[model samples]
Target chain A: MNEYFSDLFSGAKSLLVGLSVTIREMFKPVVTVQYPREKLEITPNFRGHTELVKDPETGTHKCISCMMCQKECPSDCIRVKGEKREGVKGLALVSYSLDFTKCSLCGTCVEVCPTAALEYSQEYELAGYSSDEFRFDLLKRLEER
Target chain B: MTPEAAKQDKHTFVLNMGPQHPSTHGVMRVILEMDGEHILEPEPVLGYGHRIQEKMGEARPWPGFMPNTSRMDYLSAMIYNHGYVSLIERMTGIEVPRRAEFIRVITDELNRIQSHLLWLGAFLLDLGAFTPIMYTFDDREQILDILEDVTGSRLTYCYHRVGGVARDIDEKFVERTRAFIARLRSRFKPIYYDLVTSNIIFIKRVKDVVSFTPELARRYGLTGPPLRSTGISYDIRKNEPYSIYPEFDFEVPVGTKGDCLEVYNIRVAEMEQSLRIIEQALDRLPEGPFRNKIPRKVKLPQGDATFSVETARGELTYYLVSDGSDVPYRLKIRVPSFSNLSVLQELCRNMLLSDLVMSLGTLDLVIPEIDR
Candidate 1:
C-alpha cells in the first residue's frame, strides 16, 4: 500500500512536469503565420517555375533557339520552335511553351541554357481550375511583362 | 495446423491497416491476423508509391537523374543527392572542391536533424500525442529556412552536382545556422526530455514493448537507429568513412535493449551528434572554389561501382553499371527502409495491437523510400 501511494505521487509529478512545458509554451508568441492574410518574405533563391529572360540590347528574349534546354530536359515538357530570317544571325525563337503540369521543377532547363534565357520565377501561390491553365508561352509572357 | 486452416480458425480474424491510414506514415498497407487485440501475423504490402525510379534512372542521362534521387526519399533529399553525386564522382574520377565537401557535410547533417525531428513528432503522434508535432514543426521551419537560403528549395532539393554543390553559403547563412544550433541545444532538455522522455505515460507505453533480440536485427539486416537500439553500433559514417566525415569527432549512440523507447532515445541522441558534426564542419569552412571544372559531357568506364552513405534513416547505397556511356546501363538503389520493414513479419507475431503500432512507428518507415 505504501509503495502504491509513492508510485501514484510520482506519476502525478511526471504528468504535471509534462503539462508545465506546454503551459510555458502557451505564453510564448505564436510561430506560425496566417497564410493568405500574412505572407513571409520569399527567399531570393526560391524556385517557382521557369520564365524567359529578356535581353536588354536586343529588346527580345536571349534565346538563340539552341534547343539545349529542350534536348536536356528529362521531363520532355518544353517545346521550342524557331525560324531563321535573312537579317538575323541565329535562329529566332518563334515559340517556346512549357507544359507546367508535367514539369518536375528540377531546374535542368535553367542550368543548361547557354544564352541565360531561362530563369526561375518567384510566383509561389500558383492555383488554377484546369491543368491547361498552367501551360505557359514564354514569348507571350515576355510580351505581357 | 496448415496456413490456410489457421485463417479459418474461429478465434482469429484479419485486420487491414493502412493503404490510407495516417499511422502508417505513407501509402503502406499491412494485413494483420488478429485474435482479438493480439496480433498473430503481419504482412506489409508495398509498391503503392512506386514510380519505377530505377527504370527512370536508366532512361535519363546520368546528370539528369539528379532530381529523381531527391524524389526517392524526400525527407532526407539532400543526403540522397550527396549519395548520387558521390557515386558519379567516384565513377568518373571527378574531384570535389574542399569547400563543397564541407558544405555538403553541413547541409547533410542539418537535413539529418530535420528528418529526425519530423520522425520524432510523427512517432509521438502515432503514440497519441498531438502537441509535440506543433513543437517539432516549429524547429523544422527554422532548418528549412536555413536550407532554402542556400539550396534554393524547401524540399526535394536538386542542389548537388557531380563535381560540387550548386551554390555557396554566405555570411548570413552561417550566422542563422549558428543561432539555430544554440536554440535547439538549449531546448533539448526542457522541451524533449522534460516533456516527453520523462513523462510516465510515454515511458510506460514504449518501454519493454515490442522488444527484439540482436539476432533478430542481424537476421533482418537492420540499420540506423533500429540497429543501434540493438547495440550493434554499425553506422556507415564510422564503419566506412566517406567524404569529410573522418575530419569530425563524434560518438555513435547505442542502446542496450532493442525496444521502442530505446529507439526513440537513440534518435534523440543522434540529433545531438548531428549538431556537433555541423558545428565542427562550419568551424573548418575552407577558402576555395565551391565547384571544380568538369567536362560538359560526362561518361563512366565500362565497370560497375557501389557507393554508400548514412542517411537519416539508415544506409543508402547506390550501385551503378556504366557501359562507357553518358547513360547508365543499370542502376540499383538499396534503401534502408526496405530491409527495416522486412522484420515486421516476424517481429509482430504474438504482440498486442497497440504495441504493434508503437513498434511500427519506432521503425521510422518512410514508405515511398521503400517502394522506390
Candidate 2:
C-alpha cells in the first residue's frame, strides 16, 4: 500500500511538469505563416530559376551564346542556338530556351557564365497548369525587360 | 487440400504496413507475419522511393552531381553535400581554405541538430503523442531560417562546392547562430527534458523495451546513435576524425541497456554536443577566401577515391572513380540507412506488434536513403 502511494505521487509530479511545458507554450505566439494570404519574405540568396540579364544600354542580352552554360548544365536543360552576325566576329544571342522542369537550380549556369549574363530570379510563386509554361524563352524574357 | 488452404496456417496471419502509411515516414512497405498482435517475422520491402541516383551520377560531370547528393538524405542534405565535395577534393588534393572548413563544420552541426529534432518529434508522434511535433517544428523553423540565409534552400541544400562553400558567411550569420544556440539552451532544452524525457507515460513505453546487445549491434553493422546506444562508443567523428572534428571537445554518450529510452537519451545528448561544436567553430572562425578558383571544367587524373562522413543518420560514404575525364567512370554511394534497416528483421522476431513500431521508430530509418 505504501509503494503504491509513492508510485502515484511520482506520476503526479511528472504530469505537472509536462503540463507546465504545454501551458507555457500556449502563451507563445503561433509560428505558422498563412500561405496564399501572406507570403514569406525570402532571403537574398534564394535561387528560384535561371534568367538572362538584359544589358540596359545595348537593349539586348549580355549572353554571347558561347554555350558555356549549356555545356556546364548537368540536366541538359539548356538549349542555346546562335550564329556569328554578318560583320561581327563573335556569336550573337538568338534563341535561348531553358526547360525549367529538368533544371535542378544548382547555380552552375550562373557561376560558369563568362559575360555574367545569367542570374537567378526571385520569383517563388511558380505554379501552372500546363507543362509548356515551364519551358522558358529566357532571351524573350530579357527582351521584355 | 488446395494450395491456398495449405499455405494458410491456423494461428499465424499476415499484415502489411505501408508504402503509404504515415508511420513509415517515407514509402516503405513492411510485410509482417503475426500471431495475433505478436510479430513472428518482419520483412521490409524497399525500392518504392528509388530513383537510381548512382546511375544518374555517371551521366553528369563532377560538379553537376552536387544536386543529386542532397536528395539521398533530405533531412541532413548538407552533410551529404559535404561528403560528395570532400570526396572529389580528396582525390584531386584540392586545398580548402580554413574559413571554408569552419563554415562546413558549423552548418553540418546545425543540420545535425535539426535532423535530431525532427526525429524526436516524429518518434513521439509514432507513439501517439501529437503536440510535441509542433514544438519541434517551431525550433526547426529557426534552424531553417538561419541555414536558408546562406545555403539558399531549406530542405535539400546544395551548399558545399569542390574547394569551398558556394558563398561566405558574414557577421550577421555568426551573430544569429550564437543567438539560436542561446535560445535552444535556455528555452528548448529544459522543456524537452521536463515534458517528454521525464514523463511517466513516455518512460513506461520506452524504458527496458526492445533492447539490443553490443554483439547484436556489431553483427548487424549499425552505426551512429543506434550503435552507440549499445555502448560501442564508435563514432566516426571520434574514431576516425575527419575535417575539424578533432579540435572540438565533446563526449560520446553511450547506453548500457541499449533500449528505446537509451536511443532517445543518446540523440538528445548528441544535439547538445552539436551545439557545442557549433559554438566552438563560430568562436575560432578564421578570415580567408571562402572559395578557391577551380577550373570552369573540372578534370581529374585517373584514380579512384573513397570518402566517408558521419551524417545524422549514420556513415555516408562516396566512392568515385575518375577515368581522366570530366564525368566519373563509376560512382558508388554506401548509404547508412541500407545497413540500419537490415537489422529490423532480427530485431522484430517474436515481439509485440506495438513494440515493433517502437523499435522501428527508434532505429530512425529514412527510406529514400535506403532505397537509393
Candidate 3:
C-alpha cells in the first residue's frame, strides 16, 4: 500500500512537470508559417519540373535537340523533335514537351544534357484542373519566361 | 490461429485492427484474436503498399533504378540512395573521391537523426502524448532544410550517383549544420529527457510491459533498436564498417532490457551518437571532386554482389545479380522492416490491446518498406 501511494504521488508530480514544460513552450515564438497568408523562401536548388534554359547572348532556347534527355528519361516523360533548318549551326529544336504527370523529377534529364540546356523550374505550387495542363511544352515555357 | 477458427471459441472473438488505422502508421491490417480486452493472437497482414519494387529494379538500367530506392524507405531516403549507389560502385570497381565519402557520411547521419526524431514523436503520440510530435516536427524541418539545400529534394532524394554525390556542400551548409547540432543538444535535456523520458507516466506505460530475451530477438532476426534494446551491440556501422565510418570514433548505444521504453531510449541515444558522427565529419570535410568520371552506360560485371547499410530503422541490404549487362539480371532487397514485423506474432501474444499498440509503435515500422 505504501509503495502504491508513493508511485501515485510520483506519477502526479511527473504529469505536472510535463504540463509545465508545455506551458513554457507555449510562450515561445510561433514557428509555423501560416499557409496562403504567408510563405517561406524556397531554396535555390529546389527540384521542380524540368524547364528549358535560355542562352544569355542569343535570348533563345539553348536546347540543341540532342535527344539525350528524352532517351535517358526512365519514365519516358520527355519528348523532343528537331529538323535541319537554314543558317543554323545545329539542328534547330522544333518541339520539347514534358509529360509532367509521369515525370519523377529525378533530374536525370538535366544531368544528361550535354549543353546544360535543361534546369529545374522554381514553379512548386503546381496545380492543374486537367491532365493536359501538366504536359509542359519546354520551348514555349522558356519563351514566356 | 486463423480468424475463422478463433470465432468458434465462445470466450474469444476476432477483431480486425486496421486496413486503415492511425496506430498502424500506414495501411497495415492486423487480425487479432481477442478474449475481451486481452489479445490471444495478432497476425499482421502486409502487401497493402507493395509496388512491385524488386521487379521494378530489374526492369530498369542500373543507374535508372536510383530514384526507386528512396521510395522503399521514404524516411531514410538518403541512406537508401547511398546504399544503391555503393552497390553499383563496388560491383563496377569504381573508386569514390575522399570528399564525397565524408559528405555521404554527414548527410546519412543527418538523415538518421531526422528519422529518429519523427519516430520519437509518433511513438509518443501512440501512447497518448500529443505535444512531443509538434516539437519533434519543428526540429525535423530544420534538418530537411539543410538537406534540401544540398540534395535539392526534401524527402525522396536521388542525390547520390554511381561514382559519388551529385553536388558538393558549401560553407553555408557547414555553418547551418553546426548551428542545428548545437540547438538540438541544448533541447535534448529539457525537452526530450526531462519532459518525456523521465516522466513517470511514460515510463510506467512502457517499462516491462512487453519484453523478450535476447535469444528470442535473435530468433526473429531483429536488427535495429528492437534488437539493440536486448543488450546486443550489433550496429552495422560499428561491427562492419563501411565508407568513412571506420575512421569515426563513436560507440554503439545498447540497452539493458528488451522493452518498449528501452527501445525508445535506444533511439534517442542513437540520435546523440549520430550527432557526434555528423560533427566529426563536418570538421574533417576534405577538398576534392564530389563526383568521378564514369561511363554513360554502366554495365555490371557477370557476378553477384551484396552491400548492406544501417538505415534509421535497421539494416538494409541490396543483393544484385548482374549478367554483364546494363540492366540487373536479378535484384533482391532484404529490408529490415520485414523481419522486424515478423516478430510481432510472438511479441504480442497474450498482451492487452493497448500494450499491443505500444509494442507495435516501438518497432518503429515504416509499412511501405515492410510491404516492399
Candidate 4:
C-alpha cells in the first residue's frame, strides 16, 4: 500500500511538470500569423497556379501557338485552339484554356516549353462557386497582368 | 518427459508482420518469434513490391527516363530529381548555369526540409505524441506552396531535367522561399525542443531504446542521417561534391551515442544545415538559361553507372545494367531502408513490441522505396 502511494505521487509529479512547461509556453510570444488582417509574406519561389506568359514586345501573348505544351501536360489540364492564320507566319493561338479541376500542377508543360512563354504563377486562391470560373482561359490571364 | 518439455519451450511463436501491415510503411514483412510479449528473433522479409527502377534509366534515355526514378522514393522525390539531373549533366560534361544550380540547390534544400518535417510528424505519430504532426505539417504546407510555385508540384515533385531545370524561377519564388526558411528555422527548433527533446516522456520512450554502434552502422552500408548519428561525417553532397554543393557552406551533424534519440538529433541538425545551404545558394544565385542545350534524342554511351543519393531516410543507390539497348539489361535498387532493416535482427533481441515499432519508426522507413 505504501509503495502504491509513492508511485501515485511520482505520476502526479510528472503530470505537474508537463503542465508547468505548457503553461509557461502559453505566456511566450505567439507565433501565429493572422491571415486577412495580417498577411504573412510568402517566398519568391512559391508555386501557385499556371499562367500563359505574355511578350512585352507586341503587347500580346507569346505562346507561339505551339501544341507541344498541350501534348506534354501530364494532367491534360491545358486545352489549346491554335491555327495558322493567313497573314501570321507562325501558328496563332485561338484560345488556351486550363481546367483547374483536372490540373495536378506537375509542371511538365512549363519544362517542355521552348519559347519560355508559360510559367507557373503564385495565385493559388482560385476557389470559386461556379464551375466555369475554374476553366481559366489564357486570354483572361493576359488582361490581368 | 522432461526432455520433451524442454524442446517445446525452445519452440517460440513466430508472427509474420507482413507485406501489408499498416505500420510496415512498404511491403516489408518481419517474421517475429516471441516468448510471450518479448520478441525472441526477428527476420525482415523483403522484395514483395519490387519495381525495376534502375533498368528504366537505360530504356528511356539519360534525362528522358528521369521522371520514372522519382516514384521510387516519393517523400524525397526532388532529391532523386537532383541525382538524375546532376548525373546526366556530369556525363555530358555540361557546365550547369549559375542560376540553375542555385535554384536547384534551394529547391533540393526545401525538399529536404519538407521531407524531414513529414518524417518528424510521422515519427512522433508512431510514438503516440500526436500534436507535433499538425505543427510540422503547417510548416510543410508552406514548403509545398513554395515548391508548387516554382516546380509546380507538392508531394512527388518531378522538377529537374537533364541539362538543367525546365523553367527559371521568378523574383517572387526566391523571396517566398527565403521568408519560409526564416520562419521555419525559428519556429521549428523550438517546437522540436519542447515537444520531443524537453519532454521526459518522449526522451524516456526514445533514449537508448534501440542502440546502433558506429562499427555496425558502417558494415550495413548506412549513409545519410542514421550514419551521421553514429558519429560518421559522410555526406554524398559533401564527399562527392556534385552540382554546386562544394560552393555552399554547411556542417554535417554527428551524434555522440548511437541510439534512437541520437538519430533524431542528427536529422534536426541536418535540417538546420540544409537551411544554411539554401541561404548561401540563394545569395550566390545568378541569371542565365535554366535548361542546358541538349538534343531531344539523348543517346548515352554504352556503359553502366551505379548512383547513390542521400535521401531523407538514408543512402538510396540505383545500379543500372545497360546492354547497349534502349532498355536496361537489369536494374537494381539498394534502398537505405533495406540495409537499415538488417540491423533490426540485432536491435529487437531483448525489446518489447512497442520498442520494435519505435525503433522502426525512428528509421523513417519508406515501404515502396524499400520494396522497389
Q: Indicate which candidate wins on DockQ.
A: 3
Tens-digit per-residue lDDT, A63-99, candidate 2:
8889999988888899999987897658987899999
TM-score of chain B of 4: 0.92
After superposing candidate 4, which stretches have Cα over 4 Å from the reference?
A: A1-145, B1-11, B321-331
Off by over 4 Å in 3: B1-9
Q: Roughly what TM-score does model 4 have, to 2 decimal places?
A: 0.76
TM-scores, one per candidate: 0.97, 0.95, 0.97, 0.76
Residue B248 deviation, candidate 2, in Å?
1.5
Ten-residue stretch with the least lDDT total in model 4 chain B: B55-64
The fraction of reference A/B contacts recovered in model 4 reads 0.18
**Pairs that collide, model 1:** none
Worst 10 residues of 1 chain B by lDDT: B1-10
User: Compared with the true structure, what per-residue lDDT tens digits does model 3 show for residues A9-53?
Assistant: 999999898888899899999999998899999999999998888
TM-score of 3: 0.97
Q: List the global CA lDDT of all models.
A: 0.91, 0.88, 0.91, 0.75
Q: Give stretches of model 2 more than 4 Å off.
A: A1-9, A86-89, B1-9
- DockQ of every model listed? 0.78, 0.73, 0.81, 0.18
Q: After superposition, how far is residue B89 of candidate 4 from its true place, in Å?
A: 1.6
